[model samples]
Target: MNAPAPPPAPRPAKPLFPEEPAERHTLSVTVDNEAGVLGRIVGLFSARGYNIESLTVADVSPDHAVSRITIVTTGPRRVIDQIHAQLERLVPVHSVTDLTEAGPHVERELALVKVAGTGEKRVEALRLADIFRARPVDTTTSSFIFEVSGSTSKVDQFIALMREVGLVEVARTGVAAMARGKDPA
Candidate 1:
């Protein structure tokens, strides 16, 4: 007697990573300021093996119950769209905007660079900082703290240049971005 064929093995779940062209995008997410919400958002990115280039979060509303998160990542355009869609579906996320795809967006980052040097090296550091328009937030005989705000690429370039002079420490505030025009996201 021919036994009834067992049901075909269930297909494996599809991978979260999609096959698509690599592209850079900035996403602005509005979410409830509740415990574990940030963890869930980050977990979604990590579980899928996606890379986050920069991430920043802050409470923007007067009520302090809502937070805005800005995340920069690189992936295929299709993948980015899928990520946005998935993020939108999250329970805590109130809105998700792909600032890269959104028209006329502005992004900025702030970095505090510390250079420790003596004599000529210190002089050169100051000279270079002046060229970059980095203000001296603090100063000592052997070190200078420079505060610079600009695009990520600009901050990277500044850091690279400072390395040659005597970069001792660095702290960066990840990307903060918003769409242009009167419309609020």
Candidate 2:
């Protein structure tokens, strides 16, 4: 009465991949500030089908030979690792560090937000801006351009509230990130 080994115990169902969920990451890459170096780095992302949420680059050295690029993107953890490895292999890229994972870091983005409203809506907008510590960089009778600098989430929250009031347009300086300690990225 073996009973066919009880049908060999039912197997659990599982997805073919079950890949890790994608998450936002900020990557800081130090590279040689030369012609076509940025293009090559961007090409790598395009070739691999990755998307860049925001990108900013500026020379960091007095000699103008070194530059730092802050790239914001979202991808699975494994894909992020791949990006780091590939970036390091680039000829001009000196180093690639994941600021989101590297101990503690500071990230900030500046946004110029325009809101157009009148009466109570206008007053409400001003009140909200004050609470957010936003400065009115430009002001006219009909509208005000607020200059806000803070973490990404803070800027997003402010923009969302403005939409409910009278959000006109926004100019943002993508994320700028750096490691907190003395160690260089």
Candidate 3:
């Protein structure tokens, strides 16, 4: 019993890939504009332990027969491909396009910002909103609701500045995206 034959050495952990960075992806999915379609798609992501950073869905086709669902997510490349494959298999999904890799797409979000203040603070808020190209949608003596639409970064910066002036609340529509070319996504 030479010290219990010296216990076997602990094995080093081996990763599938040594240094694969997690990447953010924007996916555009076309599906039938029918009831329960969104729920099913969301369920698939949840069941697989994947998170949806931002999602927006709306009817796109004039007849209201089709809807486009834009989803922003983060994962390794392999995972993103898997998401695409799985989405294609869904009964309601007609197409799943990875817009992030599809080249030349525009992404935007709309936010309604409400700030409460009077006097100089209120004036500052309005001035800052104008700088951001945001318009006052609703206003009163004490508060104002400004409508801002732009890239996610622009909206975020404007909101941060508004906080100093008197940010009371924020309501944002999740990212909406579309390919740049004349062809559909």
Candidate 4:
């Protein structure tokens, strides 16, 4: 009978636990600028065991009634979708947009990096900062506080390089993201 139908066609076995690589997603949440609102939003993430890579909040409305919160996190696609849904259910949240999935977006971060070194290290640090278009906001004999702003990866690279030269401290403003084109994110 056709060679026993080739042993009934072996079937591929599915793994018991499917592994999905975590994906980074930048979410823009619009909420009322009121007391405890930010706390509640932040609490949700903590309660769910979700980690926030970057978070930035600013009042956007002219009257300071509305605020825009940019939160960057990494998780599986299903987890991201769940986060979106939960954010939408918040009472003060006006809207939640996944800028990463929405298409082309621009994300930038500002970092105040402090490097301490002498001689060639100092010169090298300055040279690297100049190459990255970072300006020296403050300078002293042994250290310099640089104001660097650019894409997240660029800032990270600059900081890593500075570490080799003598990175003392770093203050990052987190990520501020916006969708491309004319539409508001």
Candidate 5:
């Protein structure tokens, strides 16, 4: 019978990076289309030292009373939860969605890549663009502007390849993501 079975051995604390590698998530926030509101949202991230890989904002309402912001970031599950909680607390925010956890979603970005070259370089660039399904939006004898829309990784790969060919400038539309199926977010 036990000399009062000495208190069971204390449990050890759990390790931080437990199993899975950190995951990247996309968040869509709906907020009032008022001045400084964007700043506040960004400030929240900055103040907390969180990194935003991509951010895109647009007024979606016809009345211009509401704006939608899509943000992409990477972190642990717990950290992502914290970000959602904080975003919900913002006064101007009407809704916050963690697309990664909110079921199926579709994410895409548009990029305008400019490359400058001549002869074989230019021809090769066009060939590569065609392979990537990128369309030439502008063209001159010495340069071309290609418009491409796809996943972030696709855009990144295209840009990297373009750099090797002769990347001059690049403008990306960040990321625009939305939940799939009948549900709306």
Candidate 6:
């Protein structure tokens, strides 16, 4: 007689809540140009333990009645969605757009990088800056302050290269992002 086959191995159970990978997000928030608006917005992030990687604010309206805030943060998808929802509920906020999810967008940042050196280091710094298209906005006998503007990543790479040559100080303007198409973000 043939032996009975053993019971098939049981399949592994799936997790109740699957872990979602964290991702970087760029958010554009339009709001009334009023006092304390920025403070309140920043408070929300602080209360929730969320970190703001980069932030830039400006009055985007010709009438100066409206302002735009661009923020870069990192978190899970769920958290990011919750943040968007919460921001919309605030009284000052007019609209909250997730640029990262809104399709093609343009992001740019300006950086002032100062390099101090003499001899070969100075020559190398100027050479690298020329390659990166960074113009010398201020130049002295010993140092040069170069202004570079581009995507955040490009600015970062330029700063890194400057550090190798003779980077001394750096000032960044955070990030300004906008949707690529006709739609406003």
Name the best candidate (by lDDT).
Answer: 4
Q: Candidate 3's residue-wise lDDT over 23-123, tens digit each?
A: 98999999999999999999999998677999999999989999999999998888888899999999989999999999999999999999999999999
Candidate 6 local distance difference test against the native: 0.93
Sort by lDDT, best first: what order? 4, 5, 3, 6, 1, 2
Query: Residue 41 of candidate 3: its Cα lDDT?
Result: 92
Assess candidate 2 and give its TM-score to the true structure: 0.88
TM-score of every candidate relative to the true structure: 0.88, 0.88, 0.90, 0.90, 0.88, 0.89
User: In model 2, what are the clashing residue pairs, if there are any?
Assistant: none
Give the poorly placed runs of model 2, Cα more than 4 Å off. 1-17
The total number of steric clashes, by the backbone 3 Å criterion, in model 2 comes to: 0
Candidate 5 residue spans exceeding 4 A from truth: 1-20
Q: After superposition, how far is residue 109 of candidate 6 from its true place, in Å?
A: 0.4
Candidate 3 structure lDDT? 0.93
Error of 6 at 28 (Å): 0.7
Between which residue pairs do clashes occur in model 1?
none
Q: Clash totals for all models, in order?
A: 0, 0, 0, 0, 0, 0
What is the lDDT, from 0 to 100, of the residue 19 in candidate 4?
86
Per-residue lDDT of model 5, residues 37-110, tens digit only: 99998999999877799999999999999999999988888778889999999999999999988888999999
**Model 3 regions more than 4 Å off:** 1-18
Residue 95's lDDT in candidate 3: 92
Count of backbone collisions within predicted model 5: 0
Which of candidates 4 and 6 is the stronger one according to TM-score?
4
lDDT of 4 by residue, 32-145 (tens): 999999998899999987779999999999999999999999988888998999999999999999999999999999999999999999999999999999999999999999
Candidate lDDT (C-alpha), each: 0.92, 0.92, 0.93, 0.94, 0.94, 0.93
For candidate 4, the lDDT comes to 0.94
Q: List the residue pairs that clash in candidate 6.
A: none
TM-score of 4: 0.90
Point out the higher-scoring one by lDDT: 5 or 6: 5
